[model samples]
Target: MDSSEQQDNLTESSGCAQAALFGPFQLIMKDGAEVLISNRRARAMLAMLCLAPDEPIDRDHLSRLLWPGRFEAQAKASLRQCLSDLGKLLAAADCDLLDISRSRIGLKAGAVRTDLSDLHDLLTEGKYLEATERLVSIGAIPLLDQMNYGEAFDDWLSVHRQQAEQRLQSAVSVALSALEKGDNLSEYARLSSLWSVRHPPAQTIADRKQGKVRIAVLPFKSIADPADHGFFADGVVDELITSLGQVPQLLVAGRTSSFQFKDSDKPPSKIADTLNVSHLLEGTIYRQGEQVRVAVSLVDAESGFESWAYCYDGSLDDMFAARAEVVQAITNGLSDALKLTEHASQPRKLTSDRKAYGLYLQGRALTIRAIGDGVLPTAIELLEKALEIDPEFAECWTALAEAEINMTVFTPCLDRLERCEKAAGYAKKALCLSPQQAHARIVLAFYAWTQNDIIGALDLAFEAYRLEPNNPDVLNRVGSFLLYCGRSRDALPYIEASIDQDPVNGRNYAILSGVHLNLGNIEAAVEAGQRMVDLGFPSLWLAAALAVSGDREAAIETYQLTKKLMNTVIYPPAGSAPLNPDAMDAYWLMAAKGLWSGKDQDRKNYCMVLEMLHATLHDPCDSTIVLPAIWMGEAPMVFKTLGTQITTANFFAFMSLWTNAEPINRVRLHPDFMDFVERIGMVAAWEKYGWPDLLPKPSTII
Candidate 1:
């Protein structure tokens, strides 16, 4: 055949053939046959050639692009092999897809058709209809979906994917504009829904503008059966949060903190006080069939006055618009929107798929609930499904990471290493998708601590805190890390702030108790510990405080209460409210004796319980074991444990035990203890935090 005729035939055949580059890469022949390119190099080669069919790329360039790490000779050989394999595969499909020569490689123009090429052309021509059609046909997937080539190919894939997504967004933006101009509202909404599923927006960064007016958007209450419209209320609340967050003049409380009052009966003023905000935006969602009514009020917390109240009645499809109106009203309630930044008043669309958005909100609520309960597995399942529906949802990714971390810490399903790897992987994925995600960074900080990178952990935690200063979870995580790293006094303020944001949060009380104990504020420690117990948390810290405060009867009663509550007689009782470590150990043994008062197996049980307690605090610097050892007159064990854990981040914890144990305080004169003191630099910590009042006086001999 002549050259022109051959070219026409090739174009016709190529048009008949189909290539899908969404979700997964696939090549199908005109005769309904499939072309499989399983090798990574071959796939990369095909994708690059197909993307630019008309241009002939040099063989050397192709080789380096595909195998950048290989030596020149090795890369050339590998490329040649891939070419041979690709040629055979194409031959089987009865197509000459490549123009291969010794010097150059190229795709035979019009010999193969691909979604990527059509997408590029349609977008280049600014044909929004055809572009939207092409995007929908391929399901709006990431470019070269799920392919893992080497670094070079992966980098190329990432750039192309971003470029493709931007094009898709441009088309969707045009549709949205058309809707704004009174045209094709339904069709544009449909297109926008697909685009949203394909490209869910990331969580809004907390405002950093100085002197911003603070507000808390309470979870919109459902005025109907929650089983019917709870998701609607949650979705509305989430959108309102994102909308209000865009206002540079507003310092919005995070969704997690605001949602803490979801089921609370507290009035608007009380909720505002708990969240430490001047204004509260409370709302309710009432839905009937296709119509919805949203009532919102901006209340002045201090004066108990409703500064603005509005009820928006609209179609369910206008939920986004309704939220935008509410946000504008809120801004007006604070100040004039016309005087605010232009971006502050500009309405931003969060999601067009209410179902997917509702699923995401539900997943978040479940994950937050799982923080205290142990339903993390269910939370994870819900989040995973939400991401399945909207893979690019960065907030869902962050929530999934948090749920996985909670499972790792609070549940006993996975091994430590597996849990660490999974939790870290999720956190990294969240950060990769949204770099400014504070919750993701908090998980990463916890992961870093597990990896023993104390400095890096603290840095990440503090950075997360700065991003969302009002987020109680961030505050608690950062504060806990500080306590772990021996900055107890530094941790106190953050923990206290967390309590202010989430007063009934039992974990905050637990952390507060620990911080107070670390700082030698025994009374404050006891008070916080009591709150923790009243809130249904473990009572071990309270028992420890009582034992240390010379309240023997109360201490014993607390231990017995803890045992009864836990349904296990595992803890020991205090006797005579021990004055020193020796007496403390004796009291514990005496308590153990009382436990087996009538059993002939008393001796065996006491030994078993003692060993169990030792095992519980097996960590080298655990103050639990060290304090008891000092009180029990086991000086050698105390020194041995300290010497082993001298390089750990909890060096100050060991020093605290050594200084306050009263009996082991004699270690101040021992050469080994002095060497360790200098090795871990405890002298500086002591000078900074001050020595505990229980510390023994220096020996004149020393």
Candidate 2:
């Protein structure tokens, strides 16, 4: 058991677990019921350094082993950050995990349990060969043994995949071994199969049902002779939907959600099945002069029981009142018969500007159905006219903001940021007037994000979600921000949640695409990217993901196709927020100062675009987002240039990425970058806007 003999035995051994003597440490459970476990690397690092006990591990060898594919200086800096984070996490647990100095890190012997020691103890217990085999089978040793090179990140990705596969293999082996050694395997297998059925087997998210309610507001047949007042029948259907929604204990189907079944040859049972409703409400409306008659009957979906029937007549002016009466009667019937809870509707004074509201609703109606030839333009014109008549209207402003935001997708702009800013302004105004407005808040956040103010956008998005927890747009923005933050794994759950809330929304499809890209999940990114493209938005960002996820050829092709589509199909002239390569003065400054690690042609084209963008950078404000920082070397280089000369005050201001200063971060930069120090000076900026985890600090110069 001498030290030298022990070390030799550990090194020569292979398979699962190997043991070497290490120090004793304490373990404490936190008040929050959370476990505080030492990271494998931290424990290993400590033990290695502790080999010389309380002395620093040689920085060079440490960096080489700990952070492969990273610059030595950069790796050293990250080790500092990792230690800092671990210190904070442990300090909260009242554990002093490390004491660090110029080049050393050491753990207090009593601070925490060393899992490495535990694994060793377990391996040394009786079945040494079996334990070693298990550790090797699990692949931790391979990960521990790796000493990666900077020029081979793709190889790192391979290592990551191999590590994952090895983990699965190890897990299966352990499970099988336990099965062989223990009993009652039948229950575990059955439970595992049952649990698996509760969720989708792939990346596709399955929608879960929330609160359920059963009631139907029967569709009313038109009594206005079918020839003249065709619009009146629609109005009656609309009024009923509005009135029924006032009841909280109801999932009343909207006219749009219901009318699809109209005139279809489908039977009532089939219609009910399609709507996913538990009851059917069918009725008719007839108008004779100033008076109108409406009839409705509720049919149970499951038992086929007749729930109730109702009829109403009222003068034209009291038409709305009559509709309200029908809603009240249905709720009263349900309460009296089924003993269900009744929700009271909150009363509000009708808006004073009824004429303007009418026009606005008309515009909204067009906008909601604003699909097909001439529909979008017609909706925009109507909304514009409504705004013209009542320029200060909050809802109208929000709607206008949405239309304009959508407009940028298909139309070219002199500057996308400028147009996006204008949309943001409108949304902000809408929020100012009605702070509880969900749609406006969602749009404002989206605007902030596109403009690269990620923290601001996320705050607004979360605020919007709080205002209307079920708001699909808010969830979509949250999902998008998660991806932007490089929490793609986290983003998937959020985006998937949005789809569950509003599966039919084309916008959610877009957010899902970005989440996939964030995970470096290339095929999934492509699938979701195609969905977004088919749903009619540019996939420039998606193309970038495709490029990095080892699909450079497809990415190049996607770029060519998207460019052609923007020119020929989407816009004929001034085809996009065109970046004119001819306009840049210092284009080669970027190319000459630094180089893109991408394909040479990509480098060439990107350098050309950077030239155009750089000329605009001289302006006090530039429309170019920091997206250039992501895709190529242009932005960081310019930021480097600005850092060298920009005034101290301006430099400080530019450091706040959350406060309308950070450039859009589209590319997740590689860590071996020269700008890490400057990027550190502007850390707040990148954290609030750039890829959060991948915030590669500018490298330290020797």
What is each predicted model's overall lDDT from 0 to 1? 0.60, 0.49
Report how far residue 498 has shifted in candidate 2, in Å: 1.7
lDDT of 1: 0.60
lDDT of 1 by residue, 1-702 (tens): 112322332344445355655544556666555566777678767776665556687999878878888899999999889888988987777777788788999876677776666655555565556655654444323445445557876776666666656765675676568665867666665555445334411111122325777788888878765466487788767766766665666667766668778878988778877677888888888877778888888788889888777687888778645566666665565454224554454443234556666676677777777544446777788788877887777777777787776665454332444665676788888777677677788777666654545445655765675555556677787667656444565567667766765666665776787677767788998999899787666665675566556664676567556544543322222111213646555555554333323233643454344455555542434444444444333445556655554322223233234223323345544446556544444433332222223332132011
Per-residue error for 687 in candidate 2, Å, reads: 6.8
- Please list the residue runs of candidate 2 whose C-alpha ends up more than 4 Å from where it truly belongs after superposition: 1-316, 320-341, 344-355, 366-381, 384-394, 407-410, 413-435, 446-453, 532-568, 572-599, 606-667, 670-702
Q: Give the root-mean-square deviation of each candidate in angstroms.
A: 21.0, 16.7
Weakest lDDT window of 10 consecutive positions for candidate 2 = 655-664
| Per-candidate TM-score against the hidden true structure | 0.53, 0.51
Model 1 residue pairs with clashes: 581-631, 582-631
> Which candidate has the highest TM-score of all?
1
